[model samples]
Target: MLFKNIVTIAASAAIASAEDVYLTVKSDDSSINGNVLGFPHEGAGLNYFFLGTGSATAFTYDESAKEISYPFAGSYTQFFTVFDNFVAFSVASANTEITFEDNVLALNGSTSNFYACKDTNDPYSYSTRSYELMWYASDAPSGCLPLTLVNSGSAAASSSALPSSTSASSAAPSASTYEGSAVKYAPAGAAALLAGAAAALI
Candidate 1:
């Protein structure tokens, strides 16, 4: 009886703590990567709400419950990511891996490791054409073009503007007018309960 009561109380404490975990996306870009949206792309975000150095562009992330939100298919032209600095395991268990290009992610030491993966969500493979997926283990690849993912943005050249001249060429993440934040997923109050219990008891 004593053991069961202890378990019940321990579980409650765990739930409380897990409810509190959230991530703050910080841009590692030294210079603000301004987009066509007329706002800088250098900050932590999902779609619109961004956090920049100090509080210039700071806003709450547009996070929802129990779903990891994907940025609009077309948002960024080219965005930045850090390699091997620190790997923090995801707090939102709803999405185990983050989607950057085709890659899935895993927590690697203090550095969160990201790699290339084919889009499972798409009806067909997004990388079936000219592009190749990359996995940056310790650092960005040597002797390769500086790596950044391209997204759809107002600052980006129009579809008509994409070069017919070469398939290899692509634009960087474009500067754009800052819209409001895109809706993103967060853990549920229930998931928080489960995670919190696991955390405290473990």
Candidate 2:
């Protein structure tokens, strides 16, 4: 019984320490080749951006909870799709479990729901869009480009792939669009505040 218990604990610890996954787009265009998914440091109303690969966010997917989260200030923030136009990291209940297949991040196994909208004025910032359900790429909103998310491996494994200079200005653009979008950030205790605000409004 003691041996069995120890084995169980080890398995649990392995699951808890899952590998981190990085996200990047797959396209023939050289400019967008090295950009990765990330968000600004400020909380709320800021869209997720395709920052340079060196500064891309690292995420872990919990199969048991069916959720994807990134490390924040000593904790984890769940990724959520908001207004069907942008992705955000917050303390909300994020039920969607993003799956990676053949190097492409899919929404419930469908790849057509993801889109990347470029900011024509700022080539370094590319807004991301994720729908709850599958949406045809052909029917995507104007100024948005179909995105194929690829797993760039964990931090240690991806180190060699990083460019010498990780500055956003060094990143180039593969496409051009003029859509304005922003992502919302909610800290650990923001959920209660949001609930209270909603209750008062009602």
What are the models' TM-scores?
Answer: 0.25, 0.57
CA shift at 144, candidate 2, in angstroms? 2.1
TM-score of 2: 0.57
Q: Write candidate 1's Cα lDDT for 51-107 as tens digits.
A: 111111111121122222222122312112232321111122322223323221222
- Please give the CA lDDT of all the candidate structures: 0.24, 0.45
Q: RMSD to native for every prediction?
A: 16.1, 9.0
Q: Which 10 consecutive residues of model 2 have the lowest summed lDDT? A: 171-180
How do the residues 96-188 of candidate 2 rate in per-residue lDDT, one tens digit apiece?
566667767776656656655543233122223221111343566565555576777744223444455322321111111111112222122
Model 1 superposed RMSD (Cα): 16.1
Query: Clashes in candidate 2: how many?
Result: 4
Worst 10 residues of 1 by lDDT: 166-175
